[model samples]
Structure formats: C-alpha cells, structure tokens
Target: MRHATYNVNGIRARLPRLLEWLEREKPDIVCLQELKCADESLPIADIEAAGYGAVWHGQKGFNGVAILARGDAPKLRRVGLPGDPDDSHSRYIEAEVGDYVVASLYLPNGNPVGTEKFDYKLKWMERLGSHARVLLAEERPTVLAGDWNVVPEDRDVFSAKATRHDALLQPETRAAYRTIVHQGWTDALRALHPGEDKLYTFWDYTAGCWQRDAGFRIDHLLCSPEAADRLRGAGVDKWARDQEKASDHAPAWVELV
Candidate 1:
C-alpha cells in the first residue's frame, strides 16, 4: 500500500488541485495538513465523491488536519495531541487505517527567532516526543506523517546560511525532532535516498523558490519499526509543486510491502 502526506495550505482553495492529485497518484491513504477551514466548512462531499472517506479536525482560517482513506473511512482514534489539554490548535489527528496507526500533524511554524511562537514550537515538539514514546510502546505499525516544519539538517535545505534565523532550521527544533526519531522511528525519505543531498518537499511561493529549486525537506513520514520493515519506496511529488496555483508543499509519500 501507498501512504502520502500533503500540507494543502488551504483546503477550500486547493480542493481542485488536491482532487486532481488524488486521482493521479491513487495512494491508499493520505494525511493532510493546513486545511484552514472550519469543520463545517470542509468540502466533505467532494472528497467522498472522489472515493475517499475522511476524518478531519479543522480550525477556522488556520491550522487543521485530516486523514483520507481510499474506499473507506479511517477509524477515528484521536482529534488532538495528548499532553496539552488547553492547546487549541487543530494541528494533529490520528486514526487507524487497516493495520496502521497513522497521525497527521501540522507542527507550529515558529518564525522570527525570539518570540512566543518559537517557544511554543519547542514545547509542542516536547509534547509530541512524549506522546510518540507511548505510541512506540504499543509496538504496532505506525506512521507519523505531516508538515513537521523543521528542516532537520543543513543538507535538508537549499541554503543553510539563508535559513539560519528561521525557526525551522533552529538547532533546538532539529534536536527535538531527532529526539522523537531516536525512539526507533525510521525517517522514510532519508532511509530510501540517504545519499541524495538535495531532496526537498517544500518551496516558498515567493522569491521564485520553486523556479530556482530553493526548497526544504520539512514534510516527513516517520514510521515505527513494524512499519519500517515494510518500507518499499519513498519520494516527493515535485511536479505537484510546479502546478498552477499550487500549494507551497508538494506531496511526500511512501510505499510499503
């Protein structure tokens, strides 16, 4: 089966593009982030018509997430991430699809270095790490896929020097990401293309980032040991980013045996 993750930026505005991609790629399951629509406002009918059942946690005009499964609705598991009762962002959603426990997350974009947003970013990651540990304990096939918002390494970005002050490239952010992966999850893309130095999943709409191929590998699919053993292939759908009125993020995907 094939599983994919995409940060659509705004589901309302990007539904056509999204549907087009779905028809073309035909992944068995898909995790979506940045719906930017309220729960009631989601285009559920259209999605269902496309032959995918979905469970979504949407927030008005901002963060949101959803999981889509081909031919059936995923069994809902959780709406929000654990460890923060008061946190209201619709950034995480988990569900059971077939034998896999899948999570779609939109980690905070802590821009501008010294700000509350940056602090929240780190704290959120800490919470994610703690929760990931619990998931690891289950020993089930699990896939945590989404726009992680962290560049992860110098090689993951087009220009490390240009992104030094960005939250996504911050040392603490990368460290937190590493801490989670250290709990025995495989970074799918890297596992398949370890030596490819310039693989990327996101490109900014400004500064001709896409045109210049100035992109970053922010979206990721981290699979637990059980799922890792089935890892067959992985890649970024770069052509999707080149489409007209495209989202800044392209689809990142993995195939399993």
Candidate 2:
C-alpha cells in the first residue's frame, strides 16, 4: 500500500492544496503534521468531503498531527507519547491501517539551543524512542512517519558544516535520531537510495529558500525491520513546494508490497 506523510503547515491555510493532493495522489493512508489549529477548529467535514476518513489531535496554534485513511478509518491506538502526562504538545497520534501500525509525529522545533525548549526536545525524543521499542517488540508491520524536525545526517541537508550549530542539526538531535534507527528500524529514504544526496523534503519560506533549493530533510518515514523488507520505492513530491500559496514542506512517501 502507498502511505504518505506531509506537514501541511496549517490545515486551514492549505486546504485547497490538500484537497488537490488527495484527489491526485489517492494514498491508502496519509499522516499530517502542523495543523496549527484547535481540535474544534479542525476542518473535519471538509476533509471527510474530500473522500477520506480521518482522526486527528490538535492544539490551539501550534503542533498537531492526524491520520487519514481511504478505507474505513483505522482503530485509534494511541495519542501523544506516554512518558509525561503533563506534556500536551499534540505531536503524536497512532492508528492501525490494514495490517500496518502508523504514527504521525511533530517533534519540537528547538529554536534557541541553550534553553528549556531544547531540553524538552531531547526528552521528547527519548519518549519516542521508548514507544518505538514497544512497537518493534510487537513484530507487526509498523511505519513511523512525520516531520521529525531532525536532520539525520549532514548529507540530508544542503550543507553539513553550515548547519552544525543550528537547532535541528545539532549533534544531540542527530544522535537521538540515530538511537531510534539503531533499534532495528530502517531509515526508508536512505536505505532505499543509499548514495543519493540533497533529497530534501522541506524548504524555508523565508528569504527565498525554495527558489535557491535551500532545504532540509527533516521529514521522514522510519520502518521497522520487517516493514523495510517490503519497501518498494520512496520519493519526495518536490512540486508541492512550488505551488502557489504552498507550505514550506512537501509530501514524502514510501510504497510497500
């Protein structure tokens, strides 16, 4: 089945593009990030009208995640990471679609590095790692997809040395991402396209980032070992980044048998 992940940026703002994408791509399942809307504000009817069943979690102005399925909607398995009950970032939501377990995540954007926010980002990564372990233990077809807000390697971004001190490219963030991969998960894009570089999925809207192709490969699809074995192909929908009123990010996906 074909499954896709996209950080729509803001669902309300990108409704038109999203609708067009749904009609064109027709993926079996879609994981969305950064809804930037409250739960009540979610455009539920409009999404349903677009011909897909969806389940979502949202907060006031930042951080939201959702899952959409073309068939009968999947079972809601979990919402938010388990480590801290007080953490309410609306960054995680998981579901079962067909035989695969899916998770949509929006890991924190740790801006100013030496602050509480960065620390929280690391803690959140730990929680994700723990949750992933549990899912791996289940031995089911598991696909974790989302805007991880992490640069897996220097090659994943446009420049390695240039972004060394940046929040998303910091060593801690990369290490955390590496830790997750070490737990028997395959980084689908890299595993499938071993020597390829500059296959970025996100570009900044400020300062003509897209025009210059200045981008970062923050969004990802990490599959459990078993799921990786079924990998068919992976790609970035770069055209989405060029649409009028487009989001800074584009859709990325992997097809599996």
Candidate number with greatest TM-score: 1
Collision pairs in model 2 = none
Alpha-carbon runs more than 4 Å astray in model 2:
none
**Global CA lDDT computed for model 2:** 0.92
Best by lDDT: 1
TM-score of model 1 relative to the true fold? 0.99
Tens digits of per-residue lDDT for model 2, 88-109:
7999999998889999999998
Model 1 residue 181 lDDT?
A: 98
The residue-by-residue lDDT of candidate 1 on 1-257, one tens digit each, is: 99999999999999989999999999999999999999999999999999999999999999999999999889999998888899999999999999999999999999878999999999999999999999999999999999999998899999999989999999899999999999999999999999998889999999989999999999999999999999999999988888889899999999998
TM-score, cand. 2 = 0.98
Candidate 1: list runs displaced more than 4 Å: none
lDDT measured at residue 142 in model 1 versus the true structure, 0 to 100: 98
